[model samples]
Target: MSAPRFGRIGEGPAAPPGGEAFSELLAGGGARVVRIASRGHADAEGAWYDQAEDEFVLLLAGAARLEFAEGTARALAPGDWAVIPARCRHRVAWTDPGRETLWLAVHLPPH
Candidate 1:
């Protein structure tokens, strides 16, 4: 049997210049857990993400906004969360520039 581990989710380096930092915390059985750190980052104009796996995201610090291809948007604050279904077109619209915005993401097989 595998032993349990302990770690802090919010502990990580700052995002790199002009890009967010993504770290895979765990992966198994076709599911993955990731940590994302962003600061003043946003998707390129007219760009969107259409992923094959469903994503569940939770904001742990700072703030962010997500825009969808369906002409909708959602703002997220600390402790907020959202579920993006597979193939749902979306993009990171905005992130707090003054400080790092931390996120916890779980990618799961499409249902």
Candidate 2:
């Protein structure tokens, strides 16, 4: 058994954030939980990501926008979430540039 420790999910250094960073909180049994931070970040133009696993992502702070190859788009604010199915083509269109955008992501095996 593992002992529990309390910690803040949004606690980060005061330095100016650059690019996107991730921290894996847990990983086992074909599932992974991660915390991600983005500052003035977006996927490369015309680029898409197609992953073998499904991803459920929650926005913890700031805002983000995502566009899919199917021409659908979503805007997320703090406390909002999105699910990306395995093999779905998607890209980040935008993230709040004025502050850090924090995200909690859960990647799971394909159904």
Candidate 3:
């Protein structure tokens, strides 16, 4: 068999509401991996996630704020990383349109 192929996350067309554009980098009998980047505009509203998948996010550029259902919020910037537990309710609260924020999100199976 040939080696696996990986795709660029943001090179394709943009996605719609709740739509995520991702490129699968690795896949096998064990785990599947992909790269995802989301750019949010100023006053842009985000979708709420309530799934059972765990998410790991790395901020690549710009700045934004993330709000959780527990009434907690966090300001994020480049080089920052956050892990959202499974079934956690969260969304992006704010973003700068002039400066688009790039994020790499990795959705992994539950431990």
Best by TM-score: 1
Instruction: Tell me which of candidates 1 and 2 scores higher on lDDT.
Output: 1
Evaluate model 2: give its lDDT.
Answer: 0.87
* Clashing pairs in model 3, backbone N/Cα/C closer than 3 A: none
Per-residue CA lDDT of candidate 2, range 1-111, in tens?
A: 989856678874321454788788889899999888888788998899999999999999988999999999999999899989999999989888889999999999767
TM-score of each: 0.94, 0.90, 0.68
- Sort every candidate by TM-score, greatest first: 1, 2, 3
Clashes of 1: 0
lDDT of 2 at 101: 90
lDDT of 3: 0.66
lDDT tens per residue, model 3, 55-96:
788877667788887889899888898989989988878654
On the 0 to 100 scale, the lDDT of residue 74 in model 2 is: 95
For candidate 3, which ten residues in a row score worst on lDDT?
Answer: 12-21
Candidates 2 and 3, the one with greater TM-score: 2
Candidate order, lDDT descending:
1, 2, 3
